[model samples]
Target: MTTLPDGLHDFLAEAGWAGGTIEPLPGDASFRRYFRLRDGERRAMLMHAPPPHEDPVPFLDVAAWLTANGMRAPAIHHAEPEAGWVLLEDFGDDRMRDWLDARPGDERAAYEAAVDALVQLHRLPPGPFAPYDMDAYLREVRLFTEWYAPAMGLTVDEAGHEAAWREALEPLLARQEPGVTVLRDYHAENIMLLDGRSGGPQGLIDFQDALVGHPAYDLVSLLQDARRDVSAALEAAMLDRYAAATGAQDDFRADYARLGAQRNAKIVGIFTRLAKRDRKPRYLAMIPRVWEAMERDLAHPALAPVARWFDANIPGDVRRAQGGKIA
Candidate 1:
């Protein structure tokens, strides 16, 4: 089991959260650590990060920016700069996954709420927020070819397949879309359903690392989830729904499908790496779900060529690893 610094208990004692128990929370990619501490309605979170590995500074800066721009983020109360620990406002206990999984009939309604929230988030003006440029995005996408292929003991056909992936992505990059802050992890897990709303306003955890990216990126994140399964018909309907909501051109569906291919490709490599490099095996199970979404998305008209490539080149095993029963 992973752990925080030795003085963590002493530190919590000093924060008036003494009676609260400490339970370590599961993390995805970052080096930061989280703990759920509570005694009652007075719930709060503790974050720990070490230098070079993680830093809460950007999170602080962005949280203020998001607050000013009308988003509900964890309110910071106390902090120790040298120690990398902060006490934050509790968003309470409703993970969107639990809420949606409990009622599949309510899925579309909740997703619609998420789409509306994405609209508001993307609409934010960008003078204060730093640019999430192509360099960072491209660097992120390359993770599949770099970390993924190596972990799988696969060559990745770097000279060939890598090019295909980029060529497939060029149109998406050319789209030149501007959006407000894009919570790169805008999926069910991070979103919280507050009160009676079907997919209540975002509770917003893990957004300190948000990238200033295309609004559609986040929409892809929510609808074409890597972990949970979203039906193809639902994905299509939601794609159209988002377009109608924003009055965007129907071309949005094509762009959405293409982007789905790009994102899922990166994720395939990522899950392999997570297991091989980080020794975190849980991510391996998510491999196929992401692939399934990619396959369904590639069925779109604009992605016909991409579909052809996967059909011909990306092995049957690749698809199987991506989560299809192959019946």
Candidate 2:
């Protein structure tokens, strides 16, 4: 029996869920919290995203758009966005990461379905969302210098870093097509595997920060997951599958690589910030995995400029170290 706020209790009661059991679920990196509610045979998920630090409007809007578009975002049963509480359809506990951990043999099939979902999603025009443009890209990549570099006790060439990222990213941005809806966090953990759904269409979650961006962005997020290992062979095969399906073989690889490097750099900074500023040190352990994925992406020719910047700024020892810890 977890203690909840008076506002949440009133919201649930107004939604006809009074006297239900409230079970708090594990939280994620954001300021949001979730709980499971039960009344008789009924079950619903409660998303408590308090304002000032978090907002539920974007999540509610995106969920509606996805469900309306015939995708698998959790159906919103009830919502009071001003109060930062949303009651949602329960897409039970089978996250893609946990599911794969139990059935390693199902990896390929599961990933194929995931890729197909992305194909379906990319076909839809982007919703009302901000563009993941040059300023956005630069702001995200600078997290490395702003947080991770200082935390690692290393002073880096901030000017060179920006120049390198510009050289690598501008070309990709220049030739961008009509952008697709990019679920900025489309990795395994954020994806759910619903039980008894035929073909196991994934249940999408944690996409409040959706944006209009290159098609390659979400693909990189899925295949180069930070919390888990996606083998090189599987990544290549998936890229091939996406290319074959979409006829985007021309410059997809470069786009994927550049975005991958940028995304991973941002993750490195975020994880460091979480540890340093937010007092959540567990994220520190994931930095090494993120570094490996970033390195793989930086190997692509399109990422040469950024790679050179990293080589000149971040020492090889720090790059290889777990969590980028100096000590």
Best by TM-score: 2
TM-score of each: 0.86, 0.97
**Poorest lDDT segment (10 consecutive residues) of candidate 2:** 318-327
Candidate 2: C-alpha lDDT = 0.89
Error of 1 at 222 (Å): 0.4
RMSD of each: 3.3, 1.4
lDDT of 1 at 151: 56
Q: Which digits, one per residue and each the tens of the lDDT, describe model 1 over residues 86-149? A: 8888776777888877877889888888788877776777525555565655566577667765
What is the lDDT of every predicted structure here? Answer: 0.72, 0.89
**Residue 98 CA displacement from its true place in model 2, Å:** 0.9
- Per-residue alpha-carbon lDDT of model 2 for 1-327, expressed as tens digits? 567765988998889998999999888998899999988999999999998899999998899889989899999999998989999999988889988898888889888888999999988988788899999999999998998999989899999999999999988885555788999999899989887332488999999999888999999999999998999999999999888889886678889999999999999999988888888899988888899999988999999999999889888888778555733
